[model samples]
Target: MSTTLVQIQVEEKRFRAHQVIDRLALDIRAGEIVSLVGPSGCGKSTLLRIVAGLETDYAGRVLIKGAKPQLHSPEVGFIFQEPRLLPWLSVADNVGFEAGRGGGKHPRVGELLAEVGLAAFADAWPKQLSGGMAQRAAIARGLFTQPALLLLDEPFSAVDAFTRMRLQDLLLSIAAHHGTTLLLVTHDVDEAVYLSDRVVVMNSGPGRIAGDVVVPLPRPRDRRDPALGRARSEVLTLLNGAQQDYHDIAPDIAAAPPAAAPIDWSKLSFAV
Candidate 1:
């Protein structure tokens, strides 16, 4: 049997007398892409943060490769919701920051820049690049360490629809090419279905895993594919059911329009 890349066992936590994540258990195998979908404040991001070792004040055991999580370890990479790049640093410098001075720059930094189609802006400062470009740089930086696990917290949520689609494709390609295990937290059901091998639905506040469904879609998925639509609907149903009590606070899943038309891939350029 194959070994698991990461595992969370009975992970529980509370903040200010309120439970955040309770009894959350999950296991991700090597090379798998698992997306966590839930309403806002469902502790999806918090759970991810805990797994990434960004937050240690929590209950339960988080095991990475059968050992405790090490946030600063080079084996894990985290991509936050915002690009969070240094305005003073150039693109290459930002991506290679973690390598430290003379840490033997990441051999894949240039390749990653090309993969995200940011080669032309290698010397550009963060403030000079477009929203998409900055986020791409953030992704490149996260991958510079060649982490075994990549944790993304709505990394593309801040971009335009077109840019979001392009970044999604780029992320999928990069993950597959690197054989990196991924745990993504996103509110967009369609986005989760488009990029994930498995969709793990979480219940609102005092969050816990509600459902674990395999996507079963073919690789190189098109956003408008009928299979993707079905998967989105399934996830929507799960989320809808999970939102019963907090109806007024959650997004209107019932009123959401069907998946938008197929994404335009031609506009998305990548060199790697």
Candidate 2:
């Protein structure tokens, strides 16, 4: 059996004393792309953060390659919603930041810039590039580290529909070429279904894994394929159902369980 690239077991967490995620478990294999789909504030990004070791106060274990995650380690790379490039840096400099001063001279930097179609904009500063180009530069920056796993949190949410579609294709092609394991968090069910090997649906607040659907469609997936349309519908159904279920359970949860009294705020302490 192939070793898992990322693993989470019985993970739970709260932000500002309000529960966010609870009892989340997942195992992702190398070279596979897993997309987390849910409504906003469903803890998809929080879960990605926890996996990336950005937050450590959460309960449960997260293991990358059977070892604890390290933020300083190059094993994982993260791509956020925004491009977040330095205003003064040129496109090539921003993407090649991980490399030392002389490192931009590396052929891989040019190759990656070309792959993301930013080769022509190499000398363009952050302000000079379009939204899509900046985001592409950010992607190249993330890939510059050559991580074993890539965590993307709504990386295309801000882009136009046409640009979003193109980026999705680029992400898939890049992941396929490098055989990088990817975990993408997105609200777009169609985008999730189109790009993932598996789609993991998360419940609303106090998020948990509600559905784990395998995408059996052969890749490279055609976004317009009828089979893909059906898959998208199925994922949407799961997301909608999970949202309803959470809504129905909210009232009961608000009324604390009789045996297990209300949590003691005084004794509660944040994890390190």
lDDT of 2 by residue, 1-272 (tens): 66788889746798778999889899999888999998778888888988899888888999999998888568898999999998877778888887867456667789999999988888888998889988999999899889999999999999999999999999988998888899999888889889998999988767888898888887887778998888888898898888787767786753445687789999999999
> For residue 195, what is the lDDT in candidate 2?
93
Candidate 1's TM-score: 0.87
Candidate-wise lDDT, in order: 0.86, 0.87
What TM-score goes with each of the models?
A: 0.87, 0.88
Clashes of each: 0, 0
